[model samples]
Target: MVTLEQVKHQCRIDHNDEDTLLLGYVAAARDHVQRYLDRTIYDVAVPSEDPDGVLDNASIDQATLMLVGHWYAHRESVSETSMNEVPMGVTSLLAPYRHIGI
Candidate 1:
C-alpha cells in the first residue's frame, strides 16, 4: 500500500495542510488500481476461511503512486476521461497487473 507520506514526498508537499486531501487521493488511487486489476490488493473484509488475497506487487505500488500524482496534479481540471486516459507511464506500470481473463 502506498502511504500518504510517500505520495506527499512524490508531490513535494512539505506541509500537513493538505494531508486530508492527499489521503483521499491515496485511497482513490488504490481503489482505481483495484478496479483496473479487477481484484483487491488488500484482504480487508474477506472471510477468514478464505486465504488472504493481498497483492504486494511493486507494479501495483508504482501504479498507485502514478495515479495519486496525476490526480493531485489535475485536481482542478473539470473533464471526464476514460480510466485508460491515464499517462503512458502509469498505464505501462499497470499493464503487467491487468486481468487478461474475460
Candidate 2:
C-alpha cells in the first residue's frame, strides 16, 4: 500500500492538513492500477524491506503517482468522466503489467 507520506511527497505537499484527502487519492489510485493491470500490485506479502510490498515495480509506482497527481489536480472539476480513465502516461506505464489470459 502506498503510504500517505509517499503520496504527499509525490505530490510535493509539505503539510499534513490534507493528509486525509491525500490518503483517499492514494487508495483510489492503488485500486485503479490494480484493476488496470488485472493483478494485485500493492499490499502483497513479500520479504522486502519496503512497506509497499510488491509495489517495487517502477512502472507501477509511476502509474500510481500519475493517478494521484491527476486526482489531486482535478478534484474540483464538475465534469463527468469515467473513473477508470487515466492519463496516457499512466496507461502506457501499466501496459506491460496487464494480464492477457487465453
lDDT of each: 0.75, 0.74
Candidate 2 residue pairs in backbone clash: none
The estimated TM-scores of all candidates read 0.75, 0.71
Model 1 pairs whose backbones collide:
none
Model 2 residue runs over 4 Å out of place are 42-55, 76-88
Best by TM-score: 1
Give the per-residue lDDT of model 1 (tens digit) for 10-94: 8989899999989999888888877776666663454555352445577778888887888888886675754546456777887
TM-score between candidate 1 and the true structure: 0.75
How well does model 2 score by local distance difference test? 0.74
Q: Candidate 2 — worst ten consecutive residues by lDDT sum?
A: 47-56
Query: In model 2, what is the error at residue 1, expressed in angstroms?
Result: 4.3
